[model samples]
Target: MDSLNYLYGFGNEHQTEALTGALPIGQFSPQRCPYNLYAEQFSSTAFTAPRATNRRSWTYRLRPSVAQLGFRAYPLEGLKTAPLNLVTPPDPMRWDPLPLPSEPTDFIHGITTIAVNGNADAQHGVAVHLYVANQSMNSRVFSCADGELLLVPQHGSLHLDTEFGQLQLAPGEIAVIPRGVKFRVQLLDDSSRGYLCENYGAALELPERGPVGANGYANDRDFQYPQAWFEDNDTPHQLITKFAGHCYLTELPFSPFDVVAWTGNSAPYKYDLSRFNVINTVSFDHPDPSIFTVLTSPSDGAGWANLDFVIFPPRWMVAENTFRPPWYHRNVMSELMGLIEGQYDAKQHGFSPGGTSLHNCMTPHGPEAEVFAKASNDTLAPQRYQDTMAFMFESRYRFTPTEWAMQTPLKQSDYANCWNNISKLFDQNDKI
Candidate 1:
């Protein structure tokens, strides 16, 4: 990938050009673009949405997106859609990482849907998927008309070639590919595996800080957007589109990443997890996990999010005479947690890198018996929780497991036993 030149500021209107003076100044959509490039505006929201929340970008490209001759339906292997419901009682579940693909696979081919919520066409809820790829997406570009993809790499590194520019990401990092952005993922290592969230609601934005004051959690300066880069190749390449829960193939005699210069708030961006401005309690109680939210897709209801991308990064623990582990409780939102690296404080074992645990809405989840015992008796001295990174995909709706997710050998059937080992400590409560 070419060295990236970025336009700083998140959700801010910005202009950039790979070639010097290639961007038209002062206005967008000029009658004749510089260098005779075609101009196009990609709108992520309705044109009349609030100015502060509106997202769109102008691209000066050698060819517009319409250059494809036509779109034909392509099979979406094992990909599932919404309205999936199950009648069983909700349970706290855990699963080891899905085995890496035995057969050769690329990013698009390796994705296997684990669960979905809301309707993609209706633009609500989200989809959870696990991807394992041993090969790169060569001679092809992929576009998701369903929603923007929030990619979390758990293994290997990714070099993304997008219509707007190129971005490279590794484990402990994330990339947000805007809805309808065409891009291809290339493996920078031997193989790749990761978590993907298909957000079908409003575009994700930095969460409101609320009472945390002006700072904490993810900061704007920490978010990085790719600078303008374009493909000028006329070689044949395939373009795939995931639209309305189906994949479509489009043959193009040209490359789609042909934007020479572009500017807009609706573009691909990435953020390093290490850069998150972590917030924690300074006094007695543990703050809600929402305080760690990096981004949220809000719904019509206030304070309710269609999806919340929250993380547990290394931070200080200084609460006075309190259990350091997260308190046990049932919550309104469903949570799917994954460990990217190191050990999560809540689980002493079973939850490892690439492993996942699911606690649906109103399902009880917290530290296992061992973790509870450890935190309950440990001295309440100032300590650092270093060498740990975990994250969660929280949704307003409950998650329905896919057939594969249900029957997979990786499923830990004894996951609930972790809590069973907690002995009766209440008998001595009267004496205390």
Candidate 2:
């Protein structure tokens, strides 16, 4: 909000203070903090994690977090957890845009789990959710004790107030908030709708560019981390925590975001998807979609990822003679794709904006029959794909959808019809 000052760099140890001389020199826990503030440590990673990957923040706040009364069980409706109410249907699935609720809902109440993988208790998987809200959160905060969240707004804008600061985001942009960061989501337009990936594995990091070198894809500088800003309020507030796949509530006399100064790499950051540096073939053949990865949550195994956040943005198709659309085949990774705007080259017919399509592990999925035919016969010319933004949450583990996701009205019943008309093109008698 306040002119949007930010500290740039991913995983860089950053320091910011709301007031002058608020941060003490040389020590994280000084004998006494400036302005008689309380010193606290908020750790995002385990204490024994590698120094390179460890994430902990030192915050100087007016009151310690102990100001809250004991937490009580708070049952959140429509939000399901992994391995519960999940169906392993083998058929490829697609869904239309989620309709806004008729009843008034805020961000927290609007969230509905679509699918979940891995385990929150083990912190090794992810849960995908759809959130649509018509009202703003009033003095309410949500923090995930299980893992971090990668939020993508597909409809209206969102004014996200976090412990770090306020981040304003719209469609084609994303905000990644590390676990345990208290924040509130308020509708910026008439309503706000979005997708959220609750990652229970390692925190998301920028994908490495091995041969592509230092520049390409999402740059670290483009990731905007909010500057220091805090709310010094005494009004009663509600705080909710998602721990062990269950929601818990705590009522505090003041806001949890009362930090006056903080320094840590474990902070929330936002990036505009338009800033991704596109890299495509100037010669022939389409590269693997891994080249489009913006962020990744790496598993312990090599060449395997817990989750890959990939995008198919506007780029040039200048290959000399090649099938411009994606090649047909299914491998190991399960893909959950969402379109933010425009038509996807693979499924121009049924995949609409705010919609999602899925291809489970080793399932046959590619361009539709019409798209395949059109791209196969296209001329060899440099084409600029414009006004399109689609993204995928690909994972090594298969995503089992909840009952709501499988039975919702938005679920397209005839999704397989697009691929049902693949004709025998190789049986040429008069052709060629």
Candidate 3:
């Protein structure tokens, strides 16, 4: 993949065209579009949604999206969604990385759901999946009507060709494709492994800065959107759509990415995790993990989120007379964590790159015995945490694991034993 140009800003109504005078001057849909192209409105939110949160785009393409043929049921394996039918156990779960495909596997087939929460039909919660692929979607395009996709590459790089344009993504970076946007994923390496979050609730947006003023923690200007680019292929292609926990296939005479120009705020965007300005304590005690949230999808209840995309990036640890690592405590929000590169300070072992761990809502989970002993005895000094990037998909709703996830050999049965060595340290006489 070549070094491609990108449009900056998170939710800006950007206007771009591949050709001159392609977009209408002021109106979205004019009586006649420039160059005899058809105008189509792509909406990700309700028509009557408030102007502040509304997300819609106007595309001028060679042919409208309605030109595609009828869709047929296409049964895809491994992919699953909420509301899951299985009874969810409260046990803590951890798993090794899903191995790469031995045979040819594209982005769609490579996806395997680990856990899910809420319901797709009801438009809430999220689906957590692991994607391991070796091949690219050359003649195939996929769109999800159930939810938007957040891609976090953990192993190799990926080149995405979407209706909006092209984006180059890799580890240490993340990308979000809006719900119902057609796109293709091309591998830039022999094999790729990553985590995918299918957000079924409200679209993810930058969390409110609140007392932090208007800066720090995933600034809006760092978000990179794709510029308008299209292909005019007349050959046959496949459009696979995932709707209501099922897959459907549609045949088309040409590529679905025929939009010559577009103007909208609802489009795919990518952000480098390194750009996140770390906001930590210079005083004492570790702050809440919410401070590291990159994006959030809020639920109906105030202060409660349907899903929060949080990262534990490399930052300086300088809390006077306090434990530098995370403290031991159960949470109301369920957490599904994945390591992108180095060791998460809380769990130095077992949690490797691409591996996953789940601490369901209120389930007892904290630093392992080893991490606990080390952090408790280590001196408190200003230390730069280097070579680590871990992330979590935290949700208000508890996630139910899929059958494949429970039965897979990668599931670590001995994961809970890591805390068995926690000896009783409650010496009442030892208090200073």
Candidate 4:
């Protein structure tokens, strides 16, 4: 794949030695293009070309790309590590297991480390919640104003009653409920369970193919979209909606999930993560982490991203003269990493499945003593990285640490010592 280069700013010509490059623009052609003195009123100009006008709008101008956008791009300070913000910690005292509604309809209930409180501190755009229930019933109706909801099953199977009709969601399967749409989950087996990611922004989109061409990573056809299904049942059904940090229940005469026969670009869908086309370097070095990105919410600024959801799945590692694992570096975006299973290659100790680590914007984090020693001593060869699966919830905003995350007993106390062992590698005679 060719390196990606961008041309920002006006009045400056930038050239990319790489074959793949993008020319950023400040204004659209035909609207803001330089007018020709001797040509007809509609004569085409360099800026008036159809391609130029289509690529950019007249309201904004282009600028050059920088390694980092600088502090002015973000509102918060303390880029390295923002203090944790924990307004509502997990309260087992508040854990109230509600019985399924006695009515013959869909119902959901469970406990979560994070509550469904409407407070800003309690409600993240990506609220992680757990769900469990028994018996199958009619699908219930629910909607989110902020973003889509991802149902990640940890156990059991779910029969989803969606606009696309009845569908079964088994363990390891993920269902996506788009924002503003109504849907319900019914347990196919005796017991059902899972984790939920309530996305509060743009829907998860396919990453651009760029120079990699149409191959590698997730392909568009691999995505499964549900067909339309609508129900005409008329009864007093409650429709619950979450908006602006508050939950509102509205009594409706029929199931809101009923979309009898609607067809459009907007609809709920699901996909198997296993189908993702994993990309890696076979010879010299590891590729950019972005290669593993499943979805990205680009920032208002061009090129830079607001949030990028990257995954580290099991794959082969065959790089030569490379560390094979991720190299150490401070990032501009705050990274919140979570493990689903197996060990992460970067941090060999402390980080475990179900555990989380936050490397706030610009905070340095990498391999611990154990991983470094093993990598330094291991013979270079074609290696297969197996049984490991991890993910990162990276955001442009510096994470305001939750007090619970910082104070929890689960927090590793010896994390700071991971870098202490590196001092042994320094030598005065090695100074250049």
RMSD of each: 1.6, 1.5, 0.9, 15.4
lDDT of 4: 0.52
Which one wins on TM-score? 3
**Residue 80 displacement (Å), model 4:** 24
Ranking by TM-score: 3, 2, 1, 4
State TM-scores per candidate: 0.97, 0.97, 0.99, 0.66
Taking the tens digit of each residue's C-alpha lDDT, what string does model 2 give over 324-395? 888998979899999999989887688988888889998898898888888988887889889999999999
Give the per-residue lDDT digits (tens) of candidate 4, residues 1-432: 112122222111222211111211342233332222011111112344354221111111121111111121211111111122445322111111222334332334342332221123322334445455665545345555555676766557776775434455765456666665556676766675555655554445566778889687866655555543445566555555556534555556555443323222344555566777898887786787889987665545664555567778888888887777787778876676666567889876666555556676677767777777788778998887777777776766554443334455555666677778875777888763
* Weakest lDDT window of 10 consecutive positions for candidate 4: 36-45
Ranking of all candidate structures by their lDDT, best first: 3, 2, 1, 4
For model 2, the superposed segments whose C-alpha errors exceed 4 Å read 428-432
Candidate 3 C-alpha lDDT tens digits along 347-397: 867888999999999999988888888887889878999899999999999
Count clashing pairs, candidate 1. Answer: 0
Candidate 1's residue-wise lDDT over 1-432, tens digit each? 335666666788878898887788888878898899888999999999999999999999998777778889889777776657655358898899977888989998888887777888788989899889999998978989899999999999999999888899999899999999999999999899999999989999999988878877788887888888877878898988988888899899988889998888899998889999988888998888998999999999899899999999999999997888899999999998888889998888898798888899999989889888889889899999998899999999888877788888888999999898888788755764
Error of 1 at 322 (Å): 0.3
Q: What is the lDDT of residue 142 in candidate 3?
A: 98
Report the Cα lDDT for candidate 3.
Answer: 0.93
